[model samples]
Target: MNKRFIKGTMAALVSMLATNAFAATEVTVYTAFESDILAKYKNAFEKTNPDIEINWVRDSTGIMTAKLLAEKNNPQAEVVWGLAGSSMALLKEEGILKTYSPKGLDELRSELNDPQSTQAWYGNDAFFNAICFNEIVAQQQNLPKPTSWEDLTKPVYKGHIAMPNPASSGTGYMQVSAWLQSMGDNQGWAYMKDLHSNIAHYTHSGSKPCVQAGMGEVAIGISMASRGAKLKTQGAPLDVITPAGIGWESEAVGIVKVSDAAKRVVDWSISKEANELYVEMYPVVGHKDVEASVANFPNVQQKMAKMDFARMGNERADVLKTWSDKFDGKSEAK
Candidate 1:
């Protein structure tokens, strides 16, 4: 071959390699993680993979799930980073989730992994129900600190409480379901009936009830303990109470179908670096031995009720409907 021809071939190969290396891959991620933590998660991911940019669409769990379901036919999200496991199960049932187990998946607890053939979603961390009591407000109102779920039903707490609405918040439904599972259906209903009389409001956002309590809008707020602890650490004068028995949900991740871009994102999501980031925010990571605590997180993990994720997903719709029929749209005092 002529020298010029050989040089041209070498240059073509070099250009091809350069083009592949410089190609930017962007992934669209839909998540339910709080807005405050979005920047941190995004920045950490970007720091390691500068070539890939993450476009996050964050919202409350219900709204995010509904959006994903609505877009099922023509999926947009490449991956779901932090969402309720139950919501992912619903999506999996609809065949919208792509089953690709991430690296270090075996390190996760068995119960946290997907059992079905497709293995639709993976667990990141567990979030449980707890109460946020405004100590100052509770004392001023002469209210007794709540020690158990039943304590919230006392006549003393009447018209001084807030909780998430089951119809709108995943945490809300989980609490109701946990009660039914723990207290038995009949007793649970009875308990809720009594507790309902005291509820000041039913919030649409799962984390807002605690936020409202942290702000002293209500003397007591029923919400996720993680949010409560985080708030309390921020000088909210909020006392996070993990009643004797509490409901829990896992923050989960899943790859959305219909995107080659999403597959790539999921591939990295299950890697060691990604799990490390998850551990920073959530103490209970699925991959075994990645246990680390967030500041101000109490030893509430030991108190969590044994969750039945399969049953929860199977009966979620019925449970929500029953809860709505029984409590939603009803007038309550604040």
Candidate 2:
């Protein structure tokens, strides 16, 4: 072979490769998924669909919702992969989400997705609220382990409890909504008033409270059960406590109206394989066939509160406003 001919062929191949790389569909995804698992999810999706690539924009659920609303006029995200269902409902109300029923929609529990004639989003997995009690800190403070939600409000727990701020965290909002539904509106607010006195401070992210507790920064943290379980697995001297009735929220995915690539991403999101991956980290996945037994995590079926998710979504604005008026001033910095 002629050297010149070989060099020309190589140049042509390089140019073709560059063109193909540029032609690959890039989907911009917004998510409130935990930072530790974001890369794994992305890599798995890309591995299955090598023709499509994901560009993630991540933040806490509250922040992501506000940003999406802000960008209503000119949307930037192609899809929303891991945000609370309540947040997605709010986006649906704003007329931002594109209606899509993914391939495995029927396999999911009907209650997990939007029930309207035109579905706006589909659930992937659920996260439940739990108490993370640092064994070392509790022992040092001479505090007994709390087994119930009411137990945290006792005088002995005062100034030793850390919780997430509702205005900035989905887990916080779900807990507040669950309390109101389970305890009656009036009694729930009253309970919070008492609970507030015991709270040392409220953190910005749902996972932070548990992480702080695991580090012995606080004796107890009212946060996501998954975070507590993960911390405990990492050898944090913490006890993952699931109260009698626990607040929980589903994490869902939705497509924006813009871009053809969005549908491809949405389709992949609801696949059985995707649900299997979700269950590995979240346990409570949408697909009925998928089940996981994560260490230190409670059985969701036995512990989940009887929640009206739609009602909670509808009343979110009023609930957040009331909560902010009562407790926002007490929140610690992010």
Candidate 3:
């Protein structure tokens, strides 16, 4: 072969290898999923698309939402994997999310998808407020198991309650919002006032309250149902309880307007595999066809009230402010 031709062939080989090396896509995902489930979700997605790598930033729903909103102009996240729909709605309202409906949108519950023509988000799963009672502590204290939301306000439970604060936690905010809608605004605030007196502390993360209760830091925690059930299965002396009425919100996913890779990820987010993964964690998945077990909160479907999506979105800030003014600085800070 001619020396120049041989050299050109070698160069072509190197260029080809470099192009292949740079072909893999990296999607930056912001999420509010628990620390334990993060790895599993990442692994599952990577397994199916080995060429695509996920860079995840995980935190509580409220914190994640705040972080995303702060970075709106020079947005950092490629996609949001698991966040509150209410938070997503707020982002959509701000026009930060890219308008793209995934392929599986028709399969999801109508209430879970974005209302606008350019759908900004899609729901994955839901979580609701529940009670976590430390059976050992309750037995020792000779405490009776409370079956209603109002039962936690009893004087006997003073300094033995923990719950998330609405200002900083989506789960907390949803529960409060649900109560106000269900019991009427005036009565809900009155009920919360009575309940606040018994609370030991208001946690930063919604599920932290239940974990604290399970660990015996507090006798009871008002938190989401799944977290309490998982803690109990881990041998925490806790029993997960869903009261007669509770507020619920769906975990959702959306594409940030900043990246093409994010748009691709969002396009894939509502596929059958993602739906299956969601059902594994949440019984009432975004898709009605999917079924899974939720051992702790029985009949979870029946317990979820008719939530007004628009109403929640509109009143979120005001409701949170009202809650803060009424209850903030009242609990002992940890």
| TM agreement with the true structure for every prediction | 0.79, 0.81, 0.80
TM-score of model number 3:
0.80
Local lDDT at 72 for model 2: 97
For each candidate, C-alpha RMSD in Å? 4.7, 4.2, 3.7
- For each candidate, what is the lDDT? 0.81, 0.87, 0.81
Clashing pairs in 2: none
Screening candidate 3 with a backbone cut-off below 3 angstroms (N, C-alpha, C), the clashing residue pairs are none
After aligning candidate 2 to the native by TM-score, how far in Å is the CA of 279 from where it should be? 3.1
Residue 160 in candidate 2, Cα distance off native in Å: 3.4
State the lDDT at 312 in candidate 2: 79
As a whole number from 0 to 100, the lDDT of residue 209 in candidate 1 is: 91
- Tens digits of per-residue lDDT, candidate 2, 181-260, equal 99999999999999999999998888999999999999999998989998999899999998877888888999986566
lDDT of 3 at 9: 97
Which of the numbered candidates is closest to the native, going by highest lDDT? 2
Q: Choose 2 or 3, whichever is better by lDDT.
A: 2
Per-candidate clashes come to 2, 0, 0
Candidate 1 TM-score over all chains jointly: 0.79
List pairs with backbone clashes in candidate 1.
Answer: 107-288, 108-286
User: What is the total number of backbone clashes in candidate 1?
Assistant: 2
